[model samples]
Target chain A: MAQPIISFNNVSKRYPGGREALSNINFTVEAGEFVLLTGHSGAGKSTLLKLIPAIERASSGTILVNGQSISTLSGRGIPYLRRNLGLVFQDQKLLFDRSVFDNVILPMLVTGQSHAESTRRVRAALDKVGLLDRERANPVALSGGEQQRLCIARAIVNRPTILIADEPTASLDDEYADAIMEMFRSFNQVGVTVLIATHDRDLIAHSSPRVVHLQRGRVLDKATA
Target chain B: MNALIRHHLHSLRQSGVRFASAPFAALANMVVIGVVLALPLGMYLLVSNVQSLASSIPTEPQISVFLTPGAAKTDVAALENRLRAVEHVRSVRFVSREAALASLKRSPGMADVISTLRENPLPDAYVVTLGEGSAAAAERLESELKGVPGIAHVQVDSAWVRRIDALLSLGRSAVILLSALLSLALVAVTFNTIRLQILTQREEIEVSKLIGATDAYVRRPFFYWGGLLGASGGLCALLLVFLAQVLLNRNLSEFGNLYGVELRLQFLPVADAALFLAFAALLGWVGTYLSVSRHLSKIQPR
Candidate 1:
């Protein structure tokens, strides 16, 4: 009934060297929807995810996030647009020089959230990711799984409406991957939109969630097949 | 309002931590900046003192009325009274030839030089002090003294003072040129330092941008750090200048005594110190702004 939270209409992307990353894609994701974008490496899964946050601009067509066309957003407008979106990376982009707490509170600091409120929210976010006990620990000392979870905590700390993770569980063991999926499941259960890009078939097979499969640069016609 | 204040406070605290983290490196940078600025500052003090000494030359413009060698004593007395009657002349004193030789013999190193002479070779003269010390006024007084009877030659005795004044003006210009060059070098040093810092923090900058940091949010801490570094450098420069003045003034005074000249060396003044610190801080902020602006735009979340 509500407008789609993210809409991509005939979107395409081409790198500077003339390699087409995504070609004439069409998709619409409603609010509170949990979707998995599965594709091989260089099949445009990461490119598609990046387009939502305007990290990578589409070479053609349009993308609308939260019912607003984001194709013409200025440099100053990008940060405001990103305030409502949470991004997680497979590499665990945590600031190793800072403590877990500081990394978790970075988003709040950017948006000028009050110190008292930021502290409380940081504690809650860390607690949710089971990293509250390591709040004072340096991020460099964190295990890979723990580090990925820390990224998730940092991503979600701003309480964004959309959570996007690009290959969030790529290098983790099955146990840790499932635990990460479970964490995403809980966030989605709370009516947050979650789109995860991954190539792991086992994680997709066990979930039975709506999966958008891309081969090369085109999404498969699921209904026709 | 509260959040803004908090962010500023956080940036301040973080800058302090960053500075303290590598104390030795920071100290080295500050010392380099200090040395760069101190040389010009020392030159500036030296030039200012020389300028003041040149302007404060205590030589009143006096006309030396030299009579013909065989002039009568009565002619000398009459010339003194006539010189006193001039409108701009303040006082007149008669120096007899015998009196001049006696005074020269009283000098510490001049007695032997004078005793070698068979007789007093000095001419009887009248020293005419003027009411005003301007070059035009002294020139007019010299002409007035020349027209008096029994006077052969009139000399305005400020010739050497004019030469010293000319040299002091040149020294002032040189000091200005040196200060300008050193200030520019200080800015360049700060620019490189901030550039290196930006390189080391390139990862953090990228991560911060990925998480929705605005340019200002990411730049605040670096700006604070640059200003802190510059201010420290300024303080160190002040200390260096002061120490130099102290160490040099003692020997300078003794040397001055050997030449029968008094040298009073002054340290950098309060206003000048304040301006120097402000300038260093400005250079720091500008350097950081330039470095950050150039590098930050290239580091988007991609």
Candidate 2:
């Protein structure tokens, strides 16, 4: 019912060596949709995911996030674009020297949110991930599963309208992977535009969210085949 | 700016936790910067002080005007008064031919030579002291004295003043040159230390950048670290300067005991201490800013 949260128009990325990573790629992931982007390594899944939050600009086209053109946005506006989108990594990439509270508060802190506000929101986000009491624990002390969840909590601490998670559960066990996917599903159920880049379709195969798989950086229709 | 500075300080503190392993490197860099800066500063103060002491010797730069033979005593008196009235001449002393003869005989080296002379060939003269010691003043006084009717020629005694002035200027220039070189070393040492800190924090920076950290958000801690290092280094420099002054004062007092004058060496004052702190902070901030900007900008984890 609502407008598409993200839209790519004629997007193409050519590396410096004259290699085209993505060729006129077009895709739409609307609000409240859980779109999974699956592809082999170097197939441009990361590039496509990176474009959603304006991390990397398109070489030839525009990317609209929440109806705003991302590629045209200035460097300063990239943070605002990112404010509406949460990005998670498989390695968890958390500052291990800091406490869980510090890790979760990072995004809000980057946006220059006040300490009281950041603390309240960080606690709430950690609570959502069921790591409320582990706020004081160091990221290094956490298991692989806990670390990924902590990454999730950090990514969503800003309450972004769209969540672009790249391989969120790639390092986790089956149970932890299911947990992370379930967290994504719950966020999607609450009307977030979730576009996850992952090869772990088994975690969400039964649920049947709209799957947009890619092969060699081009869209493929596995269903009809 | 305060928020930006605070954030940098916090980041520095965060990064500093893991950097505990390399405390010696940081301290060594700070000490090296402090020592390097201190050397030229100390030399500058010493040279300036010594030059001031030498210039305050209180001997006026003077010119001697000898009267020609058979010149009228009245004319020579007039010339002496005229020399005294000249703006450049502080005052003039008149010496009659006989008095000049007696004084020459009393001279340590010339006493025997004067006793051997058949008559007092020494001319009557007027000695002129100028208010300021300079080539122009000396020339002005010399020209005026030469113009007097009874005067022979004016000999300006200005060699010592020129020698001392030249020495002071040369010394000051050397101090400036030395200070410049040391300051470069100071910045380089601080910069390299900060660069290593940046290098060491590459992982932390990459992780922070990957997780939506803005450049400022990421750079806060390092900025503070640099600022603190510089500030503390400034404190170290100040203390070292003060300590050096104290040691010099002791040595000078010992020398005074040898000379029975009880003199002391002066240290940099409170104003200088404040300036040193500011200088230290500026150098540290610049070094850190340079290193952090270069490294943090390149830390793209993807």
Maximum-TM-score candidate: 1
Worst 10 residues of 2 chain B by lDDT: B1-10
Ten-residue region with minimum lDDT total, candidate 2 chain A: A216-225
In model 2, state the lDDT of residue B299: 68
Per-residue lDDT tens digits of candidate 1, residues B89-195? 77788888899889988866788788788878888888877765566788877777665667889998876776677787787788889878887787788778878
Candidate 1 residue B44 C-alpha distance from true site, Å: 0.6
Model 1 docking grade: medium
What are the models' TM-scores?
0.87, 0.83
Question: Residue by residue across B1-302, what tens digits does model 2's lDDT show?
Answer: 35455465556666576347568876786687778777877787788677767766754677878878889879976776676676656777777789978876775567877778888787877777777545677777677566678878778776576777788889899998987777677677767877877787687777556555677776777777777677777787777877888888888988878744666666667797788788877877888888877767776766
Cα lDDT tens digits for candidate 1, A185-208: 999999999999999999899863
The DockQ score of candidate 2 comes to 0.29
The parts of candidate 2 lying over 4 Å away from their true place are A222-225, B1-22, B54-60, B64-87, B93-127, B133-158, B257-262
